[model samples]
Target: MGLFSFLKKKSDPADAELVVLDTRLRAGEPSRLDSEAERERQRAIARATAAKIDEIELAMASDIFDDEPAWGSAARHPAAAAPAAPQAVPAEELPDAAALPASAPAVEESAILYANGQAAAAESLLRDSLQDFGRHERLPWWMLFDLYQATGQEAAFESIAIDYASHFETSPPAWQPLLPGPGTPQSAGVAATESLCPVLDESIAPRLARLLASNAPLVRIELGAVRSADAAGCAQLLQALQTLRKEGRELVLAGADTLMTTLRPMLAVGDRASGEAPWLLLLELLLLSNREKDFEESAMDYCVTFEVSPPSFEAPKRVSTAAPATGSGDRFLLPALATGDCAALLDAIDAYAAGRDLLVLDCSRLARMDYACATALQGRLRVHTEQGRRVELRELNHLAAALLRLLGYGQETGKLRDSLRLYPHRY
Candidate 1:
């Protein structure tokens, strides 16, 4: 046959058989991956096309193919007829190939960049992954964090951390660098009176109580000597900071580098039992460390993540101003004393104690008391004590008395001292 006729000649039976086998393979029957024998058979068929067999094998091993639903015959599979692009995806918003959707390929590519020390490139790609896949996809964020660190982009790192916190309504993972003690530019020298002993988990509560009771506007915590701290310890530290913050006081951490190195991982492991977010503590630590950029970012992240799409915080519209207490006795009657209502009790005390030098909190009607309530009340009372005003705990039932005493509330040795009294004929 002439060369042109030979080129247009029909395929032989073997070649036609190969073509049909390729079609079957391309159909991607669910049964193909269901068993080793079936997969082997498909592999054997792919071998018929020596030139394209590698491509076929590679396609079969792909994560995209692996993710395909394999419920039935390939011909009947819904994906077989599905459109290539989603109808709802805005054309402009479609991510580039490097910004692969929640797939292993994207991770692998980013890992390659990181391994090659192309941190800026990795950072860019990972950021794209975050935008493309949405904030809930955590891997990109985690990967981007390492890139930021590698490049020493402290400002950028902190900015992203803040974004992570805001996106997650939680603190980003802690990456606390060690602090240089005393002589570091960030540290004001430890004051003899302000310096605290090394903080331990067991001491956190008692120390916090002392700080609040002393009503010091600024409490310095010396953490240089601490080698380790657990989640509970971190939580207590956070709680103390929060207490001070709510009362418009401040806390300073001295020698915090080592302490932070120890606490970072512990806090990151997660703690919901404290009924508080760990990030809240991390943010406080960030703020105290004078990582102002980091702090601002974290604060921003915290605010956006947790409080987005909300009006400013306020008492409910139905909530009227607390009515003026109508009594001459300077006794503040608390309707409830549970942890949830303790603040209300404090407000009531403040309202009635307006012009009086002394105020007695009447717990006869106090329906509940807990460690939280006792601590909060004690903290508030300590502020009054600092101002040379007297506040008393009176008419407490056994439970309330026990709770207050356990919390170190008494007029004599207790923070409240002789100002604290059990109900008459009750204890």
Candidate 2:
């Protein structure tokens, strides 16, 4: 598994090794570089690698157990053995081995890798196992799809997507475009939901709204731990939201879980529902392509419809330079980041995260907001709507907000935003 690290560098060693590369030592004699002996050596290496893999595969194929055995007799033997690390997989992480509920055979045990916070390692594991798993057992297709997209492996993702679609007609989206806008479009070319609710920070409500609006076929609504200010009836809202999302839709999510709702209050953010502001300059790149006269002017109609300025980033800032202001009355700047400085905002977040007693960022002014920002942030981050729409800190400038957006955090104002923060419940 760690072998890929060895292959990353492309043939760059040292000057002493350079002369060794040019000469072929056959039977302790220096010969031409492209000699038969060199070709024979390479073929031998390939055969050894392949033979080694086959031997390991055969050994693994012999066992069908709930837990992998630590030491095998085959492993200790010297004559017929190839060095093989025992394939260790979490028993609980896999599906019930007693009953797969799946039509596939039990010849090779299929493993489901559930590494939250272990994203990088998971990707590497899946990639290396892909070719072998196709014939023996299905790798966690959903995860593979995610890993492919996160690491920018489009071709690999597409191949996996096709295989998955052929196996299960209505699977989730490929990992790319994980944080699409509330009104983003889907590609008909691939077999996937044009959208997904990642449940980490992606606001499912906004994604649901987009799916409902655009009429995308496949949808995944995660109802793990959604909550609202009305503590007693939070479950009902979670159920209702799912039902509402499912209505007039092609699929339904049916289940129960041990998840409990711990609701938070909706914190206020900035007033860039219009997606304006100078620091989010990359966003300006999109506006540069905007041909419609009403694109920016009318854009607020969607997100601004409930905007809240938030405060926070983690960088440090120097307030000597003034930041560009959004339309004035509706904007607030968090004290730490309000200078319209990303460096300062990140610094403040870093400080706060490290136990510094400080308001890392805040909205300096009072501003009106709509539901769109909260809902949009929730959808983008894939957090439960009730969970996603809250702002942890406040007062966002366009740049700070944009950085958050690019990184999948958001400021939520208005009712939806209100649903996020921790608050006292009403009767």
Candidate 3:
């Protein structure tokens, strides 16, 4: 039978939600751009993206069990058809397919194991498939990778994903968020207790959505049992918190310290190359929980301690030979940005003009910044504006100026001193 026909005959309720979301997004009128524009824009993009995903999924479903394993056809496809260049692996990277134990579970059985929350059993099943049959089936390896991610086994996920890509010469399927399950709604201010295992992939979002759907004023997420987390978990946690904040509700992370501490190192590993120190998830938590002091302090410590910061614009440092670069009044000198400097830099700015009416920041020798820095800088500017302070950012670099402009800082308006444009065309 054709893919669509098969889907019609074999109905799965789990797939229904995706179809509903897609349909609603496609049919709904676009919201007001100025206020609801960004959200609506995102929905439109998601609907379009899902349409493409649907096409791929339909194709996969149609030929799930073709005459030969579907993988062989994919491997023989032209290189241009692939999304990324496949990594080359040594011969010993994967166990030989033919050398499998007779008792290895079948792929169909493994899916049942996964659905039953038997992650370990499911993992073993897929690994046995790889060992017994190798890349004859691409689906098994993708399933194994998902298991690894869900279990918070970053190293294992990386190794298997690399090997799988090398063997198949194709990128692995992306980890999807958790789907919304039937959840019993509770009253406002009721704390929800969710039993969690190691993995925090896409599933957490859907789960949290159901809990938050109660529209509770305070949603206390009891994470007393969760020991570890992955990037997906952290991201979803942030998303959950942000969603709550938007609704004027509070998401309290009960017993979050231990899990967050365990997650800190993993996040650091991911940030090594980027040099954007301090996990945004952690920072957002501190900010929303009203621990601004702790957030600022941590941000400074992370920035100052890191060796390499992400790339940003730099303004040459001017020696105070003729006059102090900042005006004679109480002013602060913006420091050169090294790796992880954004948090501390903002702290320094705050410290310099704590109680002053006029705050002057000398950006003479500013260097190296990324989007994180830009965002923090914009935040600080907004804070100053709220406080009714006269602030000036002197000798700003071209890149910094451009970033501020893109962030909605206006040069034409002299009233909003939150952003200042000095040296109209500085290189």
Which candidate leads the pack in TM-score? 3
lDDT of model 3 at residue 423? 25
lDDT of 3: 0.48
For 1-427, candidate 2 gives per-residue lDDT tens digits of: 1323354344434322434554545347664446778657655765675566566555654463212222111222223444556557422122111222244221112111211234455556655655555344333443355445434577877777777545433343423222222232221110112222213232444544444554334332233233322322332334433353335332212111111112212211244322322112211212222213333433333234345332122121111111111111111122221222234333433333332222212221111112233334334333333433322333232222222333334334454543322110000
Span of 10 residues, lowest total lDDT, candidate 3: 315-324
Model 2 stretches with alpha carbons more than 4 Å out = 1-125, 128-139, 172-427
Over 351-424, each residue of candidate 3 has an lDDT whose tens digit, in order, gives 65677786655443333234556666777766776677766665443334333444554332555633333321
User: For residues 217-310, could you state the per-residue lDDT of candidate 1 as single tens digits?
Assistant: 3344555566665556777777776566566443345455556565555432223333234446666666555566656665555555555332
**What are the lDDT figures for the candidates, one per model?**
0.47, 0.32, 0.48
Give each model's clash number. 10, 57, 12
Error of 2 at 112 (Å): 16
Per-residue error (Å), model 2, residue 232: 33
Question: Once model 2 is optimally superposed onto the true structure by TM-score, how far is the C-alpha of residue 304 displaced, in angstroms?
Answer: 27
Every model: Cα RMSD to truth: 27.2, 25.6, 29.2
